[model samples]
Target: MLLEVIEAIRERVGKDYPVWCRLSAMEIGVEGGITLEETQVVAQLAEKASVDAIHVSAHLVGPGRRPPMAQPPGTFVPLAEGIKKVVSVPVIAVSRIPPELGESVLQEGKADFIAIGRGLLADPHMLEKVTSGREEDVAPCICCMTCLDSVTWRDEGIWCVVNAALGREREYELKSAEKPKKVIVVGGGPGGMEAARVASLRGHKVILFDDGDELGGQLLVASKPPFKETIDTFRQYMVGQVAKLGVELRLGERFTVDLLDELKPDAVVLATGVIPFVPQIPGIEGKQVLLVSEVLFGAETGERVVVIGGELVGCETAVYLLQQGKSVTIMMRGPELATNVNPLVRVPLIGRLKTKGASILTGVQYEEITEAGVTVRTETGERRTVEADTVVLAAGARPNTDLLTSVEGKVAQGLPVGDCVKPRGIREAVEEGYRAGLTL
Candidate 1:
């Protein structure tokens, strides 16, 4: 079977030299998956057939299968190691391995070589930077699954939030501007910073204004959730990029109409980000009710907590709070939790939620918040009140576009990017921000 396929490939290409095809050999499909021993059989066969090399890879469909999650960096290292023991030809392992980890894998004799996918997308010159001993300059991939999401999440097209050049390699290239323009960017969020980074790199005199003394916008809050430490790494990378590119950051400066008028910049970018949506439910005035943002920031909450909404924010918040020894019950109007989360992260999240003893009530209708707890109506019209001392609001977010609207038409070109245009995740924010910078 292997020889037949190899001959067909060689015949098609008509190459004098080796074509050197690669195979997963061991794939974990959405339903039925192959085993390690099975992979060994095919790998040996390929080597006997005079194959030049073997590239080890693993495919994951989603969660709720046997593994319940897609593996991360070095996920196939063990598999590659297993194949190396059986096959004689060179073996290569590929996935999320970073430069340091990939080096260690080789030094430890795990695999002959390592290949990176998302890491390269995040930092196009990763090899150059690491080789030159300037690893700090490399933008790190946080493994947020946003790049993969560009495909699974309705074919949004490929774009990396960390590195805007991934999708638009030619358009977003950092070539100096033909004529440098004075650019003023409002907000220091992901979008705002990305805009500043790109514009300044393009030889624009860029100044970024943010009310807070530090950067990161709402990423500061979002990064506080459990297993979200990588978000901070992304934040630090963006901040560093803007600074390294010589973007004049005006931290602790508010952007008002008067400020814009005074600056008289050639172009302006608005990326003020979003505010949490507090649903107008009865008894919302009670001090016991808190927003998901508040809970994440260490606001005082009772032992028994009831979280509203079951989206990515709500589900993750539940896990965050539960890890702190708070009993959690997640109630949502939708029938599912983290419905939009990538299957890789969502599978383990859901599986952990089940075993952690946290309560999950889906298809629920929120009635009101009470001092004791929350009153919810099930999909079947069953009114059930879950007793709790604290209620968290994770309904969603509303874009903070005041800066966007106020600065409209006041400058040579005013652009509303990121959450100012629409409340979205970091992916949209960074892509739009990069485009905004390129336009200037």
Candidate 2:
């Protein structure tokens, strides 16, 4: 049947045309399909049938059983190498193989050719940029899984956290604005920075405002955790891109209706992000109690810390503190922590937290924060207080809509991006900002 398909393709394209067969090396079919040995058998069969080359790939069975290529850079090299050893045909390797890594794979004779997919999504001109000695300009793919998760979770099309113009390339491309409008972006986060970058690239005189002295809003905190160092690179890239594109940045500037009127902009983007959601818990206002942001960006903390809310932020904060030589105990009302995070990021994170000796207690109810620590009761109603010098509120956050609400309808285009629209991650924020910039 495979031979028949090859012949049909050869006939359609003519005998002189090349016909390459792409197949999964390790199929995840329930009843068992193509194993690695079977992959060699298929490759031999295709070779005998006069196929030009063989492209090897693997299927993602489920959450933990990720396809090798999707897992990491050069992840599929071993699989491709194994297949290449058994096949006479020129082998093509794929899946997250960037140019630099691909060059290494070729030098090692892993495959005859390297094909990149997601790498291109980050920077369409990645090859051109790298080859032209502009390696710094080539946006890197951190394998954050936002592109795939966006499709599965949001029912939305593709979006790159690093490149906002992934799917909407034509729509969000840097075309000169028809009318050179004045743009005021109220926020120095990823979303606001992206809006200003695109708007500025399109010839709009753009200015960005953020209340905090520093840019990168949630990203500032998100980048501080372990195994999340790439987020810092991403933040640096976005901030640098906006700066290079000439977005006038006003740090430590609070946005107001009065300030908005002072700017007198034709377009306004409110990417004010979110404020920490401090629950009305007993003793939440204690001196020892602090928000996650405070622990990360502001407050000086004690050696022992109790983190409330075992969601992504809570778990990550616990990990961060643990690395800081602070003992951490995280309490959660749910059955598990970081359930909302993609498995790629969550699994390793949980593993690292365990390795670092961070305590995670789930299916627990928060009673109150005490001077010593936080009191939590299990499902059985037995209360136990975890001792700590600091109580970090990693619970969650609420959208900051003060500026958006105040200046809504006052501008020609009043756009809300990032956490203002919804408290999602970098992907949603950047995408919304880029699309909104296109409209302006």
Clashing pairs in 2: none
For 343-400, candidate 2 gives per-residue lDDT tens digits of: 6566666776787898888888888888978888986789998998999988888898
Worst 10 residues of 1 by lDDT: 62-71
TM-score of each: 0.90, 0.81
Q: Find the 10 residues in a row with the least total lDDT in model 2.
A: 61-70
Give me the candidate number with maximum TM-score. Answer: 1
Q: Give a tens-digit lDDT track for model 1, residues 294-335.
A: 888889889999999898889888988888888999998888
Clashes by residue pair, model 1? none
Residue 121 deviation, candidate 1, in Å? 2.2
Off by over 4 Å in 1: 7-16, 19-38, 59-72
In terms of lDDT, the best-performing candidate is 1
